[model samples]
Target chain A: MEFCATWTCPGPDGPIHEHAAAFDRGRERRVLIVPALFEEQNRTRRLLVETMRRLDAAGLDSFLPDLPGCNESPQDFAHQSLHAWRRAMADATAQFAATQVLAVRGGALVFPAHLPGHVLEPVKGASLLRHLLRARVISGREAGEQLTIEGLLDQGREHGLILAGYRFNPAMIAGLEGALPAHEGQRTILLSELGGGAALWTRAEPGEDAAQAAALARIVAA
Target chain B: MSALASDDTDDRLRAILRDVLGLNADTVASFDADTALFGAIPELDSMAVAGLLTEIEDRFGIVIDDDDIDGEVLETYGNLLAFTAARLG
Candidate 1:
């Protein structure tokens, strides 16, 4: 009944790592999903489960794949780039919906390049930032430090995206700014409260769902 | 919607922005609803965005999630004011 799992698949470059969840394979016509970032992927783990259940009961499937650089899927985190991650998601989509998809939060920045239309969730760049701040806070680092975009660009490029010595592509710095995640799930917004993003995080699994049905009501009603 | 109509909040938001982004400027103007923030602002990266949200939460005493008007309202100084107006209530 629970729908979350991790797997490895042949990628355009090499063995690609992925995470999948079936919202409802048999009855659902659409799949709501996304590929989130490092800490976010871990923080939303539990909430993703709850969200999948909600989608499954509603007869939909949600597929979440760990991006190239994230999770312990035997992939090179340093080699992970935006394009590779996009391709990975595209591959995951081939396995899920033959056609439709939906994603929330930062996932909205990515959608089918060829899809007829997309449904954006309420999540935005700022939302992703919130999750990252929480990550800093939990790490016992001063969450109060106001790290800037320019600063990241400078630092990320200077060291070529090293997170405590982990190699992240410098390009990812700019990509984060331009990410306008799109989805097929009828433009909705997801909010979190106490431990909301806990699930996606390796250390904490979020227990709160800050999303309201009213956000996408207009889209559904239209 | 009207630049948050509060001199106090405006000044506070500037301070937060400067603190979060590590700026030495005493003031920043042109924060409107249509202002493009995602890519235009040099300091407003994903990490800074998170820091800004946390700062707002502590300052305004409100919980912000992705679903909230953060992304849209935060596009510019004006949008932030609008968001602050709504949250201040």
Candidate 2:
């Protein structure tokens, strides 16, 4: 598979540029990956690369774009919003015929409002965090020290902090906070301690089972 | 009993917050149980809010049902702490 260098996408403001790669095979699924936010993007980079490679070997052509304002892209930090980022991904997805657009981590939340043939992957953003927390714990980290979503409010406690990249604005945060996942912790959550954070949400666990089968089991068996 | 609970809760909360927001220990040291969050810090967005909840559930071994609360509860630092304590207790 021949991977191209960086490229640009058409945008209303200007060209939404990114570190672009493209590979062609015998008419396989065309996929686009919306990367995670802030530093999570860095930690998950290797897993993502491997995922793209797997897709390539599976004969699926895919596009992984460094959204504007991130990595080697053109959008400035302050100007990057969920809406604009969604648009950039939308533009890339439209280029595909019947290819699937899959998003990982926080990027999952940025899926287009009308997701046609979009594979959410494992789950959504909130569950990704939950899975990540577990992955880190099970891999061996201090069980007592992981951070969480509701715990972030800190009403009784003030002046807590953590290091992060990306300028996360309120509108974006509000939208994110509103989403609640069907499930949180998984096998990775328990073993996450030894593994740090990356081993969770993004780490590929191979198990084939039909989602519809599980749901129907509840209804049909019941 | 009061002092022990206070110390433990404060320490636990500080560590949790520090890790969640990517804040340094010193920054959390300056925080009490009553600081404003949400608009106060640019990083505390809805996405972070949701991520924070997942972390809390995993670390504290608590189950925060999808229907337990809404995003507004996470809009401030103090509110979040109270919510956690309530659930933990």
Return the top candidate by DockQ. 1
- Which consecutive 10 residues in model 1 chain A have the weakest lDDT in total? A196-205
lDDT per model vs. reference: 0.53, 0.52
Query: Which tens-of-lDDT digit does each residue in A1-222 have in candidate 2?
Result: 567545556555767556655555636566666666655666555455555566665666766777767777766655555666777777766754425555554665565435433322324444443443333332221234444434542311243222243444544444444553222221111212223322223212211223322221222112
In angstroms, the error of model 1 at A4 is 4.7
Candidate 1 backbone overlaps, count: 36
